[model samples]
Target: MSIRHITLAALATLAAAQSASAYELDYSIDLLVPAAWPTSVVLLNVNPSDWASSTRRGAIEDAADAFLLNPSWFFIEPLEDDDSSIGPNNENELTFTSNSALLCGSSACTHLWYSGTDIVEADIYIKNDTYSVGNTKSDNLAYAGSYRSLQTLILHELGHMAGLMDEDGNYSVMGQDWNVLHAGSTDVSPYLDADSGAGLRELYGTRVGFADLSVSHWGYGGSSGGFSTHERNIVEDTSGVEPWHTTIGGEPYYVLGAGEIYRFEATLENKSDTAYTVDVSIVISPDPIITGADTELVRIPGIALSPGPTEVWLPALVPEGTTGLYYIGAIIDAGGDVPEWDETNNGQYLVAAFSW
Candidate 1:
């Protein structure tokens, strides 16, 4: 059964607002109902002969495999080839299409058939004639010209099948801009960012037997660019500048002036089925690893974190006359309120150069 559809303009507007956190779940036309696959494992049928070349088929397979890298509870497996069609025939199929109408002037599109909130089928169709599809590792700039990365496109479409909406502004695999797959565009892995993984985990659940509450990283987002955790000086133009001011021995460092406040964001991941009301502490330490023994700068308490990823924007204030090269970091569950499988990963810190 086909559910009602939302207008693209309304969807784009909603996506823009949620871009601060970098992931959105697909909703019905009225935005009243959200949809996701009911099961943890989704099976798809593929035909090797559907592609003109073996590499093309390999690209599709590679895309599906990329999802396995995430900590989400979902799994995608390939079934034996059968006479599959690109419709709501109870078959999830990945194939090519030359129909311009189906493509909608884009390189590819995914159609999902859902009953109420449960997605029963999904069909991914790639425009075989309008674009040249291949592996992105060979050439990421292919999108700049005529070629497109089949793997990247499929990876994004699979996100749709998993009930993730198209994300804008954030550097995500589900980004509307295909150039995000290009090399050197984003610091995070191109296959799946923390945002996408967090979305998946939110939809389904965290993998069984894995309970981790971690500070994924500290970064900032800009109007022109996506979130980044790299080290770079804060300048007038924040377009390409990273969150930290410098880096030492591969560790990020934030240089702060006395009595100055800086705004930054952190990605927190809850790899457990239970939601937690936790506290996040911003601390300063002489050592690279942050701990409760360090000087506490600020404590953000009572953060409601559901399963998956949550992005929080925080302010860091440099105390008067504070001068030293220390580590400025965030410790999730700083009060140890939540029991996790690995407590060591809850803290993530960056070097801080505090100058008077």
Candidate 2:
């Protein structure tokens, strides 16, 4: 229990205290949970923060319970791992634990819940609020508005714990801000989709079996009124497909190619007030084919192009005799990075896919 606190705190502090982010997790991810996962996730996390108060503790607990209790998508494990008020280990201040029923790669999966800390929920971290983006400056949170704001915020955070994102969430709860977490700004459901999960896998540098490759469902880009506009609609008008409606229901532009690299000649257009962010990545299916002798996967990653036609491609140069066909497509980054799931169900996110 003690190590949990020390490690996370040290990591959080390390992440927060630093003026510049020395670490950049290629940040890929995988989905241990399936899309619209029907099963419930039990809260085995330990919180050091005094949760006795109805405010913060109740807020978090209610958020966690209410979120998991929801019958909509995935459910939370009913049996919580609240074994100890204080963990056995002094260093593990906050820990994440799960039952054998929900085991993943190893004990690390459950260990995160067993750790000790103020809070521990299923969620990822961005630049530490106190660390990476040093000064705490938020325009939305502090703003004078609705009473549901705090509750919404908690739900959003819990959603991240429940595997949701607002797209780096630039402006929402699931984003770089407050982790900027949100499901989708569009008709977009605020759930992480499959493509995004695959993106996470690629980013994490962990290759999983195609059978293990389950992604969350996401929407396309577009206006609230036109969230469901299909890819065919976006590319139908022109013979070669122009940038018109590229922004789809108008949020979350697709990643045409790997970022910080070749600028894939893809474009989009939309008139929705909702904005979309653009990113690129590659996902390799397990059964990679190599014409030569190398046993490594040899193929191109899928490119997500938002607001329209799904085009799959391959690398121009193959070191030797390596070739294979893989599933490729431009998923709209509606709620998550790769549009696997739309947390808010805002169909405005135009996700189009193609398989090579």
Candidate 3:
């Protein structure tokens, strides 16, 4: 099934507007109607013309690699070319053609259609006249931004071809460019963000062996003032993890001695629109344990979660003699309690080193 279909004429109009400010605008995405692919493997052909050029070709390769890294069951492979051009063909094609008239003054554009109202194919047109880096003035601050914008554009277009909609916010390349709105904000990698990865998994299924939830921002919560229970309560109330503290995966990790009680916190955000009721299972596996399959020291049942961030806090004891890298993780919606838009992003991990 196809999520969306547009003719070349309409695509040109959209491209004209989109190219105007690859720098500005909060991009929104939609899964075209009748979403989901009929087949598991989709082959694509790249235009020799686009591949002939270094700059344009690099963008194409980067975009392709992003998807290749996480296919979610649907494999998109790029095929070699011959004398034939992108046209009415059985194979999907990505082309860089010079057609200012068709582009409506935009640097590049894409058009897609299903082969039989079920299977899909697409054509990507990059306008040679307008999208040249050599022509862009380096000193023009506003215009100078177009260099990265071009790469972002290529990444964004390839996302559409792969059956994803535009997403808003600073979260993903599928979303708006965060760097433009926030000065000094690091540029978004052309790589797939959490949302994009979740969406792809939802569409095609997990990539053979990958988790549904990815976790980060871990740390231990403890009472600040003294050893007494009342003092511990006071400390817990006053102290919190700082932004600069070292984390296993951008989350906090704690080193506690034997018999110590620690309160832990972490963040979980849903990638899809669908809500799920999950068990937020927390585990402190011994040093050297890495995957979720490792034993769980504890499980917190029936935590309700949806397509956004949820902060989890629970108390646990640091066992005697526990030391080295212990894997602390929170598995949301554990055991498939509720169906999710993407099931692959359900388990997250952090490394906490324990002491006697």
Candidate 2 colliding pairs, count:
113
Reference-based lDDT, residue 65, model 1: 74
TM-score of 1: 0.53
Q: Tens digits of per-residue lDDT for model 1 on 1-356?
A: 01111221111111112234557788773376568888999987774466435666666666777666565778787554567455778888877777877776677888888788889998877777532344332343322344456666778888888898876545456764344331221122235445677788778876766556776442223334322222121211123234346544333356666665554456666656667888787777776566788787777667777665566654456567788776567788988887676676666653345564
Per-candidate clashes come to: 0, 113, 18
Question: Residue-wise lDDT of candidate 2 within 41-61, one digit each (tens)?
Answer: 334343443333344444345
What is candidate 1's local distance difference test score? Answer: 0.60
Model 1, 127: alpha-carbon shift in Å?
1.3
What is the TM-score ranking, best to worst? 1, 3, 2
Query: Lowest summed lDDT over 10 consecutive residues: which window, candidate 1?
Result: 1-10
Give per-residue CA lDDT, model 3, range 20-118, as digits (tens). 111111122223433545677776677776667776666666567655645266656665566556666666777765677545455555566664435
lDDT of each: 0.60, 0.26, 0.46
Quote the positional error of residue 55 for candidate 3 in Å. 3.0
Candidate 3 local Cα displacement, residue 143, angstroms: 14
